[model samples]
Target: ETVNGSEDIDTSMDMLQRQKYHHKRAFEYISQALKIDETQNSEQKEIAINLYQEGINELSRGINIDVWQGTGEKWIKAQRLHDKMQTNLAMAKDRLNFLATGKLSSRRPANLTIMNK
Candidate 1:
């Protein structure tokens, strides 16, 4: 029983460690994406959007596996980060679309007139 317990603990730790690695990588991708000017910087913007998509994919892969079985808090945090990455992915795609079309995907006005208060 003791040997089996040790193996279980080792397996659980390994899973948690992998999840942590995934979380860190996803955060990095989002950070890079945020630094890019997806609206104007055409060259870098494309790279940034691609990074965002990669981040979303990383999170998706991590979330697919069960993790943090012993610690509910860690599981919840990972889940939240995964959800946030999904939003980031959608926004990046929108930015990419806007960059290609010179207009927002939402179809907002292209020119904005400054109004005096």
Candidate 2:
């Protein structure tokens, strides 16, 4: 029982690390996408968008895996990471919309406008 319990914790930790990695890579892709003017490099923008979308899919899968079995702290940490990923995903979506329409999204809050930068 002790060994099994330890293994579960290890698996949970690994899942958390994987999720974090995906989130970081997504952020990088989004940053690159933001820097490139879609009019100048539409291909690169599309690639970045695809890469970030892949990352988002990975993060979403990790979130769906119920790995937070033991402590509340683990759950809280996972939730925080999930929230950050959601924010990044939203930014990516907004960027896509902006690039497609050449207009900023009016739905985004004022505070997030600053944070997106």
Candidate 3:
């Protein structure tokens, strides 16, 4: 079997690559939101955190669909995306807590503070 001058397998592989690219973009967006949250002042941090968490939750739902209903390759990609999103969510929570209180407990390297010009 062939598709568009490539084997059928290659066509599917191409689609999978596109899907993975979209998934990676979603992860990047979530990470960017977390970075934005980290730079927010105490008064605005709560709202920023809430928004970031919402985006994470939406991404998780999309991942669930991809893992359970998508093709095998997509399922594997979704699983990896989910893991990355989980890490981003944890980082967001840590930043939220730090903003709520004066204590910063994250042992990892500090994230660069995002500044709005």
Candidate 4:
């Protein structure tokens, strides 16, 4: 029983590491997408944002699984970070949409206004 429990923990840890690896890659993609959008086109940026959001969702699920497996603190920290990242990503996407459509209704910092000269 003890050996089986240890093996389960090891498997869980490996899965967690894999999730973290994917999360890091997603973050890199997001950064590259932003840079590309600034100088090239917006399509890649949108694609990257979508990929990042999907990655975030995957990470959230991994964290939930970890919590269910008895890893509480790590799961909680992962969840908190995931929430923050989601909020930031949403704000960024909203800003991008506003720039594309001249519609700030869906933008965050809800009171954001432009002062024109």
Candidate 5:
């Protein structure tokens, strides 16, 4: 009898789920910040920025998990979620810089663009 360590898939899936949870939390913070008047909600903005950064950290960790033995679906899902996290992080950094200096940072390429639609 032989035991194939199939726990890796479970672990990877768990990581992806946790990372998605973090991303959702950050999004909620951003939404809350946006709903408030920016003139009087600096504290909320700061909190949102912090949460976004935390989410980015979690995503970084989650995407780095060893998935060599896991299914391609897990890897694909992780990559897609990681990409979304990057965009969200850029938005967060831009907001933080704007709050601090009244300008958007140019460190990251714009993740968003205007559309004719």
Candidate 6:
């Protein structure tokens, strides 16, 4: 809501660039967190998990951000908007639900058991 030059920003390229920047940052955090194991009696792994969670939150912001697709061949952009919005919205909703409840949803099967003989 407060940034210099933001008042003049009104382009799909700008939106895509911002999205890419956020994605890059989130990926870095995720990669850093992925290299550590929390079960080794090390505090660093816990820190890493926290960092990864934070990165995921940031990634969600990027996914939720409004992006105005530029004027172009309307059909292509329309298809992209439909698919992209569905995927992004689903991810955001799934994360929010998971945060609220430990499980993803009741419909997800919970009775399946892996067995070895």
TM-score between candidate 5 and the true structure: 0.58
Error of 3 at 27 (Å): 6.0
Between which residue pairs do clashes occur in model 5?
A: none
lDDT of the candidates, in the order given:
0.65, 0.65, 0.57, 0.55, 0.59, 0.54
Model 5 Cα lDDT, one tens digit per residue, 1-117: 113355765676677677666666666656655555255566566665565455456545544544344456666676677677767666656665666576656554453333322
Question: Pairs clashing in candidate 4?
Answer: none
Query: How well does candidate 3 match the true structure, expressed as C-alpha RMSD?
Result: 9.4
lDDT of 3: 0.57
Model 1: ten consecutive residues of lowest lDDT = 108-117
Model 3 segments beyond 4 Å from truth? Answer: 1-43, 59-71, 106-117
Name model 5 segments beyond 4 Å from true.
1-5, 37-69, 104-117
Clashing pairs in 1: none
Please give the distance, in angstroms, between residue 10's alpha carbon in candidate 3 and its true position after superposition: 20
Model 6 lDDT per residue over 1-117, tens place: 223244434454466666667667766765666555324435574566566576676676666556543344432454464455456445544543554454756444453332221
Note the clash tally of each candidate: 0, 0, 0, 0, 0, 0
Model 1: per-residue Cα lDDT over 34-66, one tens digit each: 678635566786687687677777766666657
**Who wins the TM-score comparison?**
2
lDDT of 4 by residue, 6-108 (tens): 7776775775576566557656655654666567566565665565455445444433433334455655665565565556556555645654565766334
**Higher-ranked by TM-score: 3 or 4:** 4
Per-model TM-score on C-alpha atoms = 0.58, 0.61, 0.46, 0.51, 0.58, 0.49
Off by over 4 Å in 4: 1-4, 37-69, 99-102, 110-117
Question: What CA RMSD would you report for each candidate?
Answer: 6.8, 5.8, 9.4, 6.2, 6.0, 8.8
The TM-score of candidate 6 is 0.49
Q: Please give the distance, in angstroms, between residue 65's alpha carbon in candidate 4 and its true position after superposition.
A: 6.5
